[model samples]
Target: MASWSRLGRVGNLAATIIAVAGCGADDVPLTPEPGVAARKVTVIRGDQTYPMTAEVIDWETRPHPQVPERGMAVHITYRFRSTSSDSSAISEHVELQACAVDGRRVVLLCTSIFNGSSKDCWLGPSADPDLARTADVLILPDQMYAGPHAGDPKDHDGYVPPRNLGPGDQL
Candidate 1:
């Protein structure tokens, strides 16, 4: 089965490529709370290797369009924001360069770019509970670039790595 979402503001640039899914509502929740996997990834823009927070901002689960019998399709949307004062480190076209990993092994990955008119780049991840095991989203630093270079997006890069997003953590 494949995971995908209808295009939004960014047209082909907008990607909803979540891979967290299950055979039924029991295997995976019909709706995982938005922002569950609010995590950080290493973003490299030239000499800079900085932190960028990624969050499952929006998500939905439905029957797989191709093989509904296999299970359901999980569509999750995530965005990237530079954690440092220099926010442009994560910008347009950067989301297109990403890899989904399970441990040290790099699994299949494909994402569409949707910055929604800002540097806070959004990408949708279709889900298959089996694929969700590769829960961690790693950034392709070499491919990522700072933005057209502008003011940062509020402060979405608040979540630090090695620790899960908490109630006290500001998003």
Candidate 2:
């Protein structure tokens, strides 16, 4: 019998597919979420600041459900709204894959899945990776590279080539 965990993976895959279509981050620059006021920051990545509410900063090691040998790395999850809003989890999500930080400037190399199956990447001064957590923006980049997760030995492959940002990858 398939474990509940297995069923969960199948479910999350469908949800992730739908979420990917939205493309949370972009090169055009993400404005602070409308009415939400900017958080206080003594440090700034540039002149820009993105409005992102960090829902979960997971430090736990999560591996690929299919290939447990893959993606044994930590990641952070950001949500546009409360988790309760998710139905099929058809809820919206933007999972940052890797991130590069140049001082206060951060360029998150993001993805939608833990499996090496996704071909998408989103980057910008996303939520702090906590390694060097001092970002001032979430939609612009000075540079992009391996954030903490991509820095992991087992998870590095997913953050390269087609899965990562291009000349100027994701937002």
Candidate 3:
């Protein structure tokens, strides 16, 4: 009986360890609390790097023609700011950039572009621009993209573009 009890305890301990070890970073709750500012993320493209702030602003699990079952269509509002002297370091096509959520990367096509120019740019869905507020929706992941010059045939000063970096990969 004593040996049997000890074996049962060991089994329980092993089970607990396995359960804890199974949890990945994505398993952690990323939901942001209300009235809190979303974290800012940095993305690097080409010869420049820019800061991008994004929030889950809104989400809908409603079945759409484009989305299949068990999939959700999320609405995210984001802003991009250049860290370099040349404010235009960010491309106007930034809205089409790829974003990572819960370790899944998705491309958010620019539905609307606001305050677009050189220094500051904001992109989001066209339906509601004012809904964006600083409450926690989800943890923002660093956006990544291959710039326009990624595979240009013409070399600039013998400079070769680096390999395409996936979402969250830094320069």
Give the count of colliding residue pairs in each prediction: 20, 3, 2
Residues 56-75 of candidate 1 have per-residue lDDT tens digits of 45444445466656643445
Model 3 lDDT tens row, 48-95: 444444333344322234433433334444455565566664544453
RMSD of each predicted structure: 21.8, 21.7, 14.1
Q: Is candidate 1 or candidate 3 better by lDDT?
A: 1
TM-score quality measure for candidate 1:
0.34
- Per-residue C-alpha lDDT of model 2 across residues 1-171, encoded as one tens digit per residue: 679989999999989998887675542233231121122111112342223222223223344345544333333433332333434322323333233333434333333332122332223322333323423223222112334575466665432312343223323
Q: How displaced is residue 170 in candidate 3, in Å?
A: 16
Please give the CA lDDT of all the candidate structures: 0.40, 0.34, 0.37
- The number of the candidate with the highest lDDT is 1
TM-score of each: 0.34, 0.23, 0.31
**TM-score preference between candidates 1 and 2, better one:** 1
Off by over 4 Å in 3: 1-39, 46-48, 51-56, 65-72, 81-87, 90-145, 156-171
| Candidates ranked by TM-score | 1, 3, 2
